[model samples]
Target chain A: MRITQGAFSFLPDLTDEQISRQVQYCLGKGWAVNIEFTDDPHPRNNFWEMWGLPMFDLRDAAGVMMELNECRKVYGDRYIRMSAFDSSHGWESLRLSFIVNRPKDEPGFRLERHEVDGRNIRYTTTSYAVDRPEGQRYR
Target chain B: MDLDVVPMTGNVNLREELEAVGIEEILTQLDRELIGLKPVKTRIREIASLLLIERIRKRMGLTSEVPTLHMSFTGNPGTGKTTVALRIASILHRLGFVRRGQVVSVTRDELVGQYIGHTAPKTKEILKKAMGGVLFIDEAYYLHRPDNERDYGQEAIEILLQVMESQREDLVVILAGYGDRMEKFFGSNPGFRSRIAHHIDFPDYADDELLAIAELMLGDMNYRFSAAAREAFVRYITLRKAQPLFSNARSIRNALDRMRLRQASRLVADLDRVLSAEDIMSLEASDVLASRVFANGSSPANYG
Candidate 1:
């Protein structure tokens, strides 16, 4: 199954033009756009390795697209995502995020459940790919 | 098209679309932000109207005709070409013409390559990056070289032409350069010239306008010129205009930057005297006079 993790992941994989449009949308809203990638597809992995410095001073999507192209050249198999941060007082955090690239052969997550006292149960979600060492997990 | 609010009636509601997009607010902001460019602003308004009417016609079930938005911005440096291009991008986005209205600015070096078989990928990469927005090519004239047979700039141009025609809806390519050289470029390369629909020439700012720009810059930097210092700046403008390589408003900014440096040194020289807030903020006539342009000879001490 597809990870279905981001804004447009359910739809078709965005073409370069479509990705450029999304980047432009983020820049249009005056958000600080940044890119990240990781072989580990854990749901709680909030600190994926940043591709470059967060593009705060750029108003043009072309720069972000260029950097995205560069990042894809290296990390084509890893899951790469684009995120945007808004600096306004009320919304001083990430406003939008979308997975722009994904590795082939997505090893779906494994959900393990344990029955606790009084018929109560708890579940833990773990990524199958993480069985391999960190960097070698995806390929 | 963001025109869903407008009722789909037989008649066109031009005013509603204009208000919904807030084109007038962008135009007014353009006017207030830039110092003086009456004609440029008018042309932008005309383009906005053209796009607006095109949208209205489409809403009324007219033929779907996409007006090609490829344009040329010819002007001297520091004449607000980039600024105007950004505004045009915003306007294009607001009007629903382009998907994303950000400008990806590039120069000849960025597009053209040094050796054989390199220019195509470089140009294509840039085009991919600029997709769904404006691709602003500064000094676009440099892309054509009639004298050098081995030049790969023509390769870049050919690829650009193909994409400019094929991806007309997805991207807007804006060529910018000096007025005369751009004319020469258009003359030699008819294929390139024929693709451009709008040619906007940005004029050099007058001396008074440059002074106003300097004042505005100073204000933004939290510095103010003293009464006599303003008079000195007027003289400085006249002298700098006569000097070589004097870019209109850009040169004024450079001069003011140096003046600030001089003010810092002057303030530090008299360290014993307690400095007031006014002294920290105000630029004196001596600060303005200390430029290398004012001195008749290029002496080392006057460099301060």
Candidate 2:
């Protein structure tokens, strides 16, 4: 039931050293790192709430890690992911992304399958948090 | 914080990995549900094996860059290209290649634009919708307009190429069309051909395969042909194959629809007759023979 939207989801929630390693890897490739968090980790939910802005000038991973720590203090009950965008020629989208924070409860997702036309089954995954009203999904 | 890095190399088993990911189940279902694409099925199996090995390697802590999964499907109409694309999406999702397996099918019109500066946003919108899944472009060759000097398709193509490279781990784009025209398209657009990993050709179904498809379609509808009608349908298939625009399964489906209409007429023609379940479900040979396709000697205008 893990939200497998990014790298290292199949493994484990990364420690500080592992998170910094990934950030360093992205920074080494000249990618702009950004942090985002959301209570809804639905499969199609691409645009999570941005923590501040894309850190384009931060060359060191520790600086990004310090900013990440600040964001974690504010939204510790949400799923936060570190996404890096590469604006170089020929590739202008997210180059690297991985979840760096998750809720303590982590109530997971349920897949809904609809039988469409002949032998076609459409699948949709919805977060279990939607059962609660907005602004009160998590503690 | 300390992380646990286990020495997990020697304990990995490919068989257990395959079962854990249910790769075999997906392939088996692909074979069981689809008919007469033996070559396509085999190609899919090979790709599945490659992906399965990569998965096993990942379990053994040998992570590597995600391989490009973009593909091109070339074949005639009604050859199950879209169906196979759907199946491949499921395979990729199961193998942990993509986060979601939903297929967003589009064509040149959906991606291209009429006015200047409109194509990029149009294509980007579609790409955003297709992120985390597959973007299936049907008749993808139409995106290029060599004859037109001011076509917007080129802009769309550029955006597609960038996303195909940048967001490849999250999104897969599949270009589908007729074999020869697709070849010509790839010849002109080398960028597309270079990025695509697999080029699967869906062969036209043989007459026997088409017949099996016909029976399968009829069976699904809870309808059956009378003894003479079965032979009549076989003849219908032969005749239909010779006609122009002979789309394999699609033409057969249309033919069955017309026959069902004819059966309905035959039943309603007798207003007071007691109707049995067999009478309602059975299609007689006369119903199939009434089509303009069966008229011989002279060329009928509506032969379709």
> Which candidate number maximizes lDDT?
1
Q: What is the C-alpha RMSD of each candidate to the true structure, in Å?
A: 8.6, 17.4
Q: Residue-wise lDDT of candidate 1 within B1-304, one digit each (tens)?
A: 2334343666656677789888889999999888987778889989989988887776776746677899999989889999999999999998887776768999999999888888976787678667668899999988998999779999999999987887677789999999999999999989888898999989889888898999999999999999999999999999888777778878788889999999999999998999889999999999999788888865533332
Interface root-mean-square deviation of model 1 in angstroms is 4.9
List, residue by residue over A1-139, the lDDT tens digit for candidate 2: 5677788998878999899889878977989998899888887887799986687744446546766887889998888999999999999999888999987886888889999998999988778887898657777
True contacts kept of 1: 0.07
iRMSD for every model:
4.9, 12.6
Instruction: Give TM-scores for every candidate, taking all chains together and pairing residue i with residue i.
Output: 0.69, 0.68
Off by over 4 Å in 1: A1-139, B1-7, B297-304
Ten consecutive residues with minimal summed lDDT in candidate 1 chain B? B1-10
* Model 2 segments more than 4 A misplaced: A1-139, B1-7, B297-301
Model 2 chain B weakest lDDT span, ten residues long: B1-10
TM-score of chain A of 2: 0.88
Return the TM-score for candidate 2, rounded to 2 decimals. 0.68
- lDDT tens string, model 1, A13-46? 9998889778878887888898999988887888
